[model samples]
Target: MGKAMFEKEKVCFSFRLIDMGNGSQVIDESIKTPMDALTPELQAEYMEVHEQLAFMKTIQKNNRRETERGRKLVRNPLHRLACFCGLA
Candidate 1:
């Protein structure tokens, strides 16, 4: 017989807070369980999505840093001098 089918009474949304500077992440949001869940496949898929999201966050952080570095390399001496002397 096929695994018993069950419907989730309520859908749950999850969120995470990440500190891109240090590559640290925390799941600050709560997770709700599903109803009449069949095999463990669903759970596995959910975890996979979160993993992908975390990876993307890390990549985004790195990209931002690289872009900033590139901009600094193109800085004008006049601008740098202004900041150094507290005048623009």
Candidate 2:
């Protein structure tokens, strides 16, 4: 008979949950923006703006995905509301 390897490895997590009454979600601290450190040099300032813009683009993309997912979840209720209120 072969010995079973059932040893469990240690895992760590720092999850945080936030509720907004209607729904709840997990928060990730890594998404937070860093402190601004702009310099007087025009090129450096432009580069900083470019970097911030790229970061914003990434965040906006993520928001679009999340919003789509949320809309999917609430589609039934929203559609019913639209029909009931004659807004559709």
Say which candidate scores most in lDDT. 1
1-88, model 1: which lDDT tens digit per residue? Answer: 4344564345443643434667865555564444234246756655676688789999999999999986885497877888789886
Instruction: In angstroms, give how far residue 72 of model 2 lies from its true place.
Output: 1.5
Worst 10 residues of 1 by lDDT: 30-39
Best by TM-score: 1
What are the per-residue Cα lDDT tens digits for candidate 2 across 1-88?
3345565433322222244777854445444322232234633544555566679889999999999987886678877798789987
- Candidate 2 CA-lDDT value: 0.56
Clashing pairs in 1: none
Looking at candidate 2, what is the lDDT of residue 27? Answer: 44
